[model samples]
Every structure is written in structure tokens, then in C-alpha cells.
Target chain A: EDQVTQSPEALRLQEGESSSLNCSYTVSGLRGLFWYRQDPGKGPEFLFTLYSAGEEKEKERLKATLTKKESFLHITAPKPEDSATYLCAVRRWDGSEKLVFGKGTKLTVNP
Target chain B: DVKVTQSSRYLVKRTGEKVFLECVQDMDHENMFWYRQDPGLGLRLIYFSYDVKMKEKGDIPEGYSVSREKKERFSLILESASTNQTSMYLCASIPRGLNEKLFFGSGTQLSVL
Candidate 1:
């Protein structure tokens, strides 16, 4: 079975603190890995998509790196406005276009 | 920017009542999906449509139905609402390719009493 797991269910950090969130997966083939940021009571916003191992993408203060078995979302000097739940989703080899998502890591960057 | 919009942000329905949640995407995406999100379960796919009038059952399609009357619109229907059915329903769309990233709506928070 294809599964995605996220570590550190919750993270609390002061403003300007930097950290990384992990997303590990077990699947036959990895089509793509997706990162999303979801605010409380709102839908998730698309962040980045990493297709191959050793691929990395960055947007503003967030950087995503991917490997064969895991992906990391690194936040640089996060602020309170950056506080939200970060989600990781994976597409498997089935071409079904369906995604298997992790439980998400709730991040709080207190200012 | 890709824009996905849902008909409602918050909804309250009673048990046994039929409910409808509508979603529209400005982007001409080939794939559209409906998902329900819970606290710990993350987002579970309920239904998806590849083209107009072409719908498929997703991972959790029981008690739910979907309609894709047009290329840019998708709707999710709850035949009979139940308390357990209360959840945050999200809609997303992606372009024609496999690697096209999904764009999501603001979501609808539904409460079944």
C-alpha cells in the first residue's frame, strides 16, 4: 500500500526560527510529491511539486527538497504569518490522479 | 493565478436533508475532484471527474455523488446528511498533465445536525 508519513505532528517556534518538516513515503513508483499550506478553517494552498529525487524548489521563505524515499519542507526564519498546517501529498504509479496525504504538521511561529 | 471558488464557506444542514456543494474553477483544468477533510484523517477523495458527464468513484465515495455538467464546474451531493458526515469539503482542479499541480478552493465547512 502507498502511504505518506509526516514527522513532528506539531511544532512551535519563536519568530525568526528556522526548521524543516519531513515527509516519508512508501510506494511502488513516485510520480510526484506535493506540498501545501493550509490555514485554520481554510483550504490548502499549493506550494511546490517535486518530481524526482534530488529535486528542490523554493518560494519566498519556504524551500522543498526531495529524495527517493522522503521530502523535506524547510522554513527559513518563519514569522507568525507563516504559521499554518503544512501538508505533504504523493502521487503513485497508478495514474489515477488521486493523492495520498499525510496527517500534516501544525506549525506555530509565535512573534 | 488559478482561481477555484466554492459556493459556500459555511453550511448547516439537518439529518436526512439533501445537500449540495458547488465548485467552479476559472482555469480550464481537465481534472476536478471533491474531497472531505477531517482533523486527523487529512483529505480523503470523495469523487472526481475527468470530463463533462464523466465521473469516477474515489477512495471514499459511499453516500456521496458528483456531477460535472460542464468543463469548469463540479458539484458534490449528499443524498442524506448525517451527523457523521459533517466535515470540511474541498474542491481542487489540475491541468491536463500528470505533474500539473492541484489548485484548491477556500473549502466549505458543513455541519450536519
Candidate 2:
């Protein structure tokens, strides 16, 4: 069975706090991994895509790195505006078209 | 920027009433999807369409039906709305390729009473 797991269901950090959120997966074959940021009551916005191990992508204050079995979303000196639920989704290379998703990690940065 | 538009941001419906949710994408993407989200649970796919008049059932399709008569539009229908059906409905679109990023709409908050 293909599954995606995201750790730390919720996190609270003060402004300027740095942290990393984890996403691990078990699948037949890894096609790609996606990261999204979703604000309350709104649709998720695309963040990054990691296709292979040793690969990384960055935008603004967030950086995403990928490994063979997991991925990490690192936040640097986060601000209140960076607060949102971060979602992880994976695509299977074994002929499956749908993307499997993790429950997501709720992040709150207090100013 | 790729844009997926959901017709409603909020909706209120009575139990047993039929409901229709509409979504349209501006990008000429071949794939469109409908998903419902809730707290503690991530996005759950309800239905998807690959081409005109082509549809597929997703993970959670019970009590729901979909229509795709055009390439850019997809619709989700609830034959009989129920309280348990209340949720945030999201619409997304992607090109035919598997690695492409999904573009999403603002989503809809549906309340069934």
C-alpha cells in the first residue's frame, strides 16, 4: 500500500524560529513529491516539487529537500505570514495517476 | 499563472436536496478533479475527468456523481445532500503528465443541514 506520513500534527513557533517538517512515504515507486501551503478555508497553494533524492528547491524563506524515503521542508526565520498548513503529496511511478497525500502539518508562527 | 475556478465559495443546502458544484479551468488542461477536505483528514478525491465526457470514480465517490461535457469544465453532483456531506470542496487541474503541479481553485465551504 502507498502511504504518506507527515509528522508534528501541529507546531507553534515564535517569529524568527527555525524548524523543519518531515514527510515520509512508502510507495511502489516514487515519481515525484509535492509541497503545498494551505490557509484556513482556502485551497492549497503550490510550494515545491522534489523528484529525486539529493534534490532540493527553495522559495522565499522555505527550502525543501528530498531523500530516498523521506523529504524535509525547512523554514528559516519564519514570520507570522508564513503560518499555514503545509501539505505533502506523492505521485507513484507504477502507473497510478492519482496523487497520494499526507494529513498535513499545521504551523503557527506567533509575532 | 494557471487558474482553476470554483463556482461557489460557500453553499447551504437542506438534507435530501440535490446539490451541484461547478468548476472550470482556464488552462486547457486535460485532467480535472473534485476533492472534499475536512479537519484531521486531508484532501480526498471524489471524482475526476480526463477528457470531454470521460469520468472516473475516485477514492470517495459514494453519493456523488460527476459530469464533464466540455474539456475545461467539471461538475460534481450530490444526489441527496446529508449532514455528513458538509465539507470544503476543492477543484484542481493538471496537464496530462503525472509530474505536473496541480492548480487549485479557492475552494467551497458547503454546509448541509
Candidate 3:
């Protein structure tokens, strides 16, 4: 079975603190890994997509890195506005477009 | 920018009543999805359509059905609303390809009484 698990269900970080959220997956054939940020009562916003190990993508203060077994979302000097639930999902290479998603990590960056 | 729009931001319906949730995308994408979000459960796929008149059931599709009569629009229907079915419904779209990012709408919060 294909499964995605995100650790540290909730994290409280002070403003300007840097941290990394983990997304671990077990699938047959890896196609792509995705990261998204969702605010309260809103749909998720796209962050990055990593297709292979050793790949990394960055946007503003967010950086996402991928590996064979896991992916990491690193937040650099996070601000209060950056607080949101980070979601991770994976697509398998079995010719299916369905994405299996994790439970997500609720991040609160306190000022 | 890719735009996926859900028709309602909030809805209130009574138990045993039928409900409809509408979603539309303007990027000419061939794939559209419906998901429900709840606390500690993240987002679970309910149904998806790859083309007009083609629908597939997702992880949780027991009490739900979908329609895709047109290329740009998808609708999720609840045959009989229940208290346990109250959730935040999300709609997303992606172009027909691999490794494409999904674009999502603002979402609709459905409350069942």
C-alpha cells in the first residue's frame, strides 16, 4: 500500500526561528512529491514538487528537499504570517494521477 | 494564473437532505478532484474526473457521487447529508500530465444539522 506520513503533528516556533518538517513515504514507484501550505478554512496552496532524490526547490523563505524515503520542508526565519498547516502528498509511477496525502503539520510561528 | 473556483464558501443543510457542491476551473485542465478536509484527517479524496462523463471514486466515496458533464466543471453530490458528513470540501485541478502541481480553490465549508 502507498502511504504518506508527516511527523511532528504540531510545532510552535518563535519568530525568526528556522525549522524543518518531515514527510516520509512508502510507495512502489515514486513519481513526484508535493508540498503545500494551507491556512485556516482555506484550500491548500502549492509550494513545490520534487520528482527525484537530491532535488531541491525554494520559494522565498521556504525550501523543499527530497530523498528516496522522505522529503523535508525547511523554513528559514519564519514569520508570523508564515504560520499554516503544511501538507505533503505523493504520486506513484503506476500511471495513476491520484495523490496520497499526509495528515499535515500545523505550524505556529509566534511573534 | 490557474484558477479553480468553488461555487459556495459556506453551506448549511439538514440531515437526509441532498446537497450539491460545484467547482469550476479555467485552465482548461483535463483533471478535477474533490476532497474533504477535517481536523487531524488532512484531506481525503472523494472523487475525481479526468474528462467529461468520466468519474472515478477516491478513498472515501461511500455516500457521494460526482458529475462532469462539461470539461471545465465538476460537481460533488451528497445523496443524503449526515452529521458525520459535515466538513470542508475542496476542489483542485491539474493538467493532464505527470508531475504537475495541483491548483485548488477557496473551498466550501458544509455544515449538516
Candidate 4:
């Protein structure tokens, strides 16, 4: 069974504070990992896609790194506008594009 | 930019009533998906279509059905709405290829009374 787990269900950070969110997974064959930001009452917005271990992607203050068993989303000096739920998902290599998603981490950045 | 649009942002329906949630994507993507979001459960796939008239049951499809009559439109149907079925429904699309990144709609918040 493929499973994705995200830690720190909720986090509160002061302005300019940096922190990391974790996503651990167990899958038969890894295909790709995805990160998304979702605001209250809205759908998730695409962030990054990590295809292999040792891969990293960045956008503004957000940096995502991937490993064999886990992934990390590092937020640097976050602002109030950066507050949102971070979602992690994985796609298997079994010719299926279906994604398994974690519960997500709700981040609150107070300015 | 790829755009996925959901018809309604909020809906109120009574129990035992049938409900429809529509989604449309402008990216000409071949794959479309419907998911439900709940607290502590994240997002769970309800149904998906890879091509017009082709539908696949997802993780939680017991009380739901889907229709893909056209390439760019996907609709999720609730045969009989229930209180437990109240949730935030999301729609997403992805182009068929190695790029499995999905573009999501604004979502529909359905309330069953």
C-alpha cells in the first residue's frame, strides 16, 4: 500500500521565522512527489514537483528537497501571506498518475 | 497558465437529494479527477476520467458517480446526499505524460442538511 504522512499537523511561526515541514512516504515504486499550498475554503495551488532523491526546487522563500524516504518543505523568513496549509502527495511508477496525499500541515505565519 | 474551474463555490442541499458538481479545465488535459477534502483526512480521490466517456472509481466512490461527456468537462454526481457527505469537493487536471503535476480548481463546499 502507498502511504504519505505529514508531520506537525499545525505550526505557528512569527514573522521572519524559518521552519520546515516533513512528508514521509512508503510506496512500491516512486514516480514523483508534489507540494501544494491551500488557503482556507479554497483549493490547493501547485508548488513544486520532485521526481527523484537529491532533487530540490525553490520559489521565493519556499524550498523543497526530496530524499528516498521523505521530503522537506523549508520556509525561510515567512510572512503573513505565506500562511496556508501545505500538502504533500506522491505518484507511483506503476503507470498510474493517481496521487496519494497526506493529511497536510497547516502553517500560520504571524506578521 | 492552466485553469481548472469548478462551477460552484458553495452549495446547500438536503439529504436524499441528488447533487451535481461540475468542473472544466482549459488546458486540454486528458486526465481529470474529483476529490473530497475533510479535516484530518486530507484529500481522497472520488473518481477520475482519462478520456471522454471513460471513468474509473477512486478510493471513495461508494455513493458517487462521474461523467465525462466531453474532453474538457468532468462532473461528479452524488446519487443521494447525506450529512456525512458534506465536504469540500476539489477538481484537478493534468496533461497526459511524464508531467504529472496537477492544476486544481477553487473547490466546492457542499453542505448537506
Candidate 5:
């Protein structure tokens, strides 16, 4: 079974505080890893796509890095508006074309 | 920007009633999907369509069916709504590749009473 697990189910950070969210996965063949930001009562918004290990992507205060077994989403000096649930998903090469997602890390940035 | 839209943001239906959740994407994506999210289970794929009239069963497709008459539209049908089926239904679209990122809609919160 392809499984994805995210750490720190709930996180609280003061404004300008930096933290990292973890996503660990076990799959047969990793096609891609994705990060999404979802607000309360809304759907997830696409953030980044990591294809291979050692790959990294950045957007504003958010930076994502991928490794062989896990991925990290680093939030630098986050603001209140950046508070949302961070979801990590992996798509395997099983031809199912389905993405297996983690439970997500709910971040609360207090300003 | 890629836009995925669902028919409703909130819906209330009784148990055993038939339900339909519609999703449409503005981008000409070849792949469209339907997922249900609960409080703890996260997001689980229910069904997906790779092409027009071509559908596939996802991880949790037991009580659901799908329709794809066009490239940009995918519909999810619940034959009989149940309390356990009350969840936030999400729709997504992606290009024709294994490594593509998905574009998601605002989601529909369905409450089964």
C-alpha cells in the first residue's frame, strides 16, 4: 500500500516565526510529490510539485524541499494570512493516476 | 490561472436520496477526479476520468459513480446518500502526465441527514 504521513497535525506559530512541516511517504515508484494550501471550508490550492530528490521550490515565504523518503515545507516568517492546512500528496507510477494524500498539518499563525 | 468549479458550495440531503456532485474545469485538462474529504481521513479518491466517457475506479469508489461526457466536465453520483457519506467533496483536474500538479475547485460540503 502506498502511504503518506504528515507530522505535527496542528501547529501554532507567532507572526514572523519559522517552522517546518514534514511529509513522509512509502510508495512503489514516486512519480511526483505535491504541496497544497487549504483554508477552512475551502478546497486545496496548489503550491508546489517536486519531481525528484534534492529538488526545491520557493514562493514568497514558503519553500519546499524533497528528499528520498520525506519532504519538508519550510515557512519563513509566516504571517496570519499564511495560516492554513498544508497537505502533501504523492502520485505513484502505478498507472492508477491517483494521488494519495496525508492528513495535513493545520497551521495557525498568530499576529 | 487554472479554474476548477463545482456546482454547489453547500448541500443538504436526506438519507437514501440520490445525489449528484458536478465539477467543471476551465483548463483543457485530460484528467479529472473526484475526492471526498472527512475530518480525519483526509482526501480519498472516489473516481476519475482520463478522457471523455472513459472512467476509472479510485480507492474509495464503492458507493459512487462518475460521468465524463466532455474533456472538462466530470460528475460524481451517489446512488444512495448515507450519513457516512457526508463529507466535503473536492474536484480536481490535471494534465496528461504522471507528474502534473492538480487544480482544485472550491469544494462542496454535503450534509447527509
Candidate 6:
């Protein structure tokens, strides 16, 4: 079975504060790992797709890093507009083409 | 731009009543998926279709069903709405290929009373 776990269910950060959200996953074979940002009452917006360990991607204040067993979303100097739920999902090589997602970490950036 | 569109943005329903959520994609993708999101439960796949008239049960399929009569459209049906069924339903579509990501609709916030 494939599983994804995100740590720190909720995060509150002051503007300019930096922190990282953790996503631990277990899968038979990893095909891709994805990160998304979802606002309240809205669908998730795709952020990054990391395909292999030791890979990293960045966008503005958000940076994502991937390892064999886990992934991390690091938010640097976050702003109020950056407040949203961070979602991590993994697609395995099972041929199902389905993504298994973690519960998510709700980030609140207070200005 | 590629888009996935859900028919409704908000809905209120009565228990035991049948409900339908429609989704359409302009990306001409062969795969479409239905998922329900809840606070602490993340996104659980309810159903998915890979082609016209083909459907597959996902992680959570109880009390729910799906239809895909066209390649660009998928529909999710709740035979009998229940209080526990209140949730934000999301629709996603992905093109067939490696490294392709899903495009999601804005979502429908359904409240079953």
C-alpha cells in the first residue's frame, strides 16, 4: 500500500518567518511527488513535481526538496498571501495512475 | 489555457435526495477523477474514468457512483445524500503521459442537511 504523511497539521508563522513542512511517504515504487497549494473553498493549485531523490524546485518564497523516503516544502519569509494548505502527494509505479495524498499542513502567515 | 470546470460552486441538499456533480475538461484528456476533501482527511478519490463509459472505484466509493459517457466529461452521483456526505468535491483531469500533472476545477462546496 502507498501512504503519505504530512507533519505539523497546522502552522502559524509571522511574516518573514521561515519554516519547512515535512511529507513522509511509503510506496512500492515512486514515479512522482507533487506539491500543491489550496485555499479555503478552492481546489488545489499545482506547485512542484519532483521526480527523483536529491531533486529540488523553487518558486518565489517556496522551495521543495525530495529524498528517497520524504519531501520537504520550505517557506521562506512567507507573507499573508502565502497562507494556504500545503498538500503533498505521491504517484507510484503501480499503473493505477492514482495519486495518494497526505492530510496536508494548513499554513497561516500572519502579517 | 487548459481548464477543468465543475458545474456548481456551492450546493445545499437534503438527506436522502439524489445529487449530481458534473465536470468538464477542455484539455481533451482521457482521464478524469472525482475526489472529496475534508479537514483532516485530505483528498480521497471517489471515482475515476480513463475513457468513455469506463469507470474505476477509488479509495472511497461507498454511496457514490460515476459516469463518463464522453471523453471530456465525467459525472459523480450520490444516490442518497447524507450528512456525512457534506464536503468539498473536486474534479481533476490529466493528459496521458509521464510527468503530466492534473488540472483541477475550482471545486463545489456541498452541504447536505
Off by over 4 Å in 5: none
lDDT of 3 at A57: 96
- lDDT digits (tens) for residues B47-74 of candidate 4: 9888899988889999999999999999
Model 1: lDDT to the true structure: 0.92
lDDT value, residue A63 of candidate 3: 97
Chain A TM-scores, one per candidate?
Answer: 0.98, 0.97, 0.98, 0.98, 0.98, 0.98
User: B75-109 in candidate 6: lDDT tens per residue?
Assistant: 99999999999999999998765556778999999
The per-residue C-alpha lDDT of model 6 at residue A109 equals 92
User: Tens digits of per-residue lDDT for model 3 on B40-98?
Assistant: 99899999998899998999999999999999999999999999999999999988774
> Model 3: clashing residue pairs?
none
RMSD for each of the candidates: 1.3, 1.1, 0.9, 0.9, 1.2, 0.8
Q: How much lDDT does each candidate structure score?
A: 0.92, 0.92, 0.94, 0.94, 0.93, 0.93
Clashes of each: 0, 0, 0, 0, 0, 0
For every model in order, the fraction of real contacts preserved is 0.57, 0.57, 0.68, 0.60, 0.75, 0.55
| Model 2 Cα lDDT, one tens digit per residue, A21-68 | 999999888999999999998999999999899999999999999999
Query: B4-39 in candidate 5: lDDT tens per residue?
Result: 999999999999999999999998998999999998
Q: Which tens-of-lDDT digit does each residue in A24-101 have in candidate 5?
A: 999998999999999999999889999999999999999999999999999999999999999999998876567899
Q: Candidate 4 residues A19-46, lDDT tens each?
A: 9999999999888999999999999988
Instruction: Compose the digit string of candidate 1's lDDT tens values, residues A1-111.
Output: 888999889999999999999999998899999999999999898899999999999999999999999999999999999999999999977766777789999999999
Interface RMSD of each: 1.4, 1.6, 1.1, 1.2, 1.4, 1.2
Per-prediction TM-score, please?
A: 0.95, 0.97, 0.98, 0.97, 0.96, 0.98
Q: Which stretches of candidate 1 lie over 4 Å from their true place?
A: none
Task: Give the runs in model 6 whose Cα sits over 4 Å from its true position.
Answer: none
Q: What is the DockQ score, from 0 to 1, of model 3?
A: 0.76
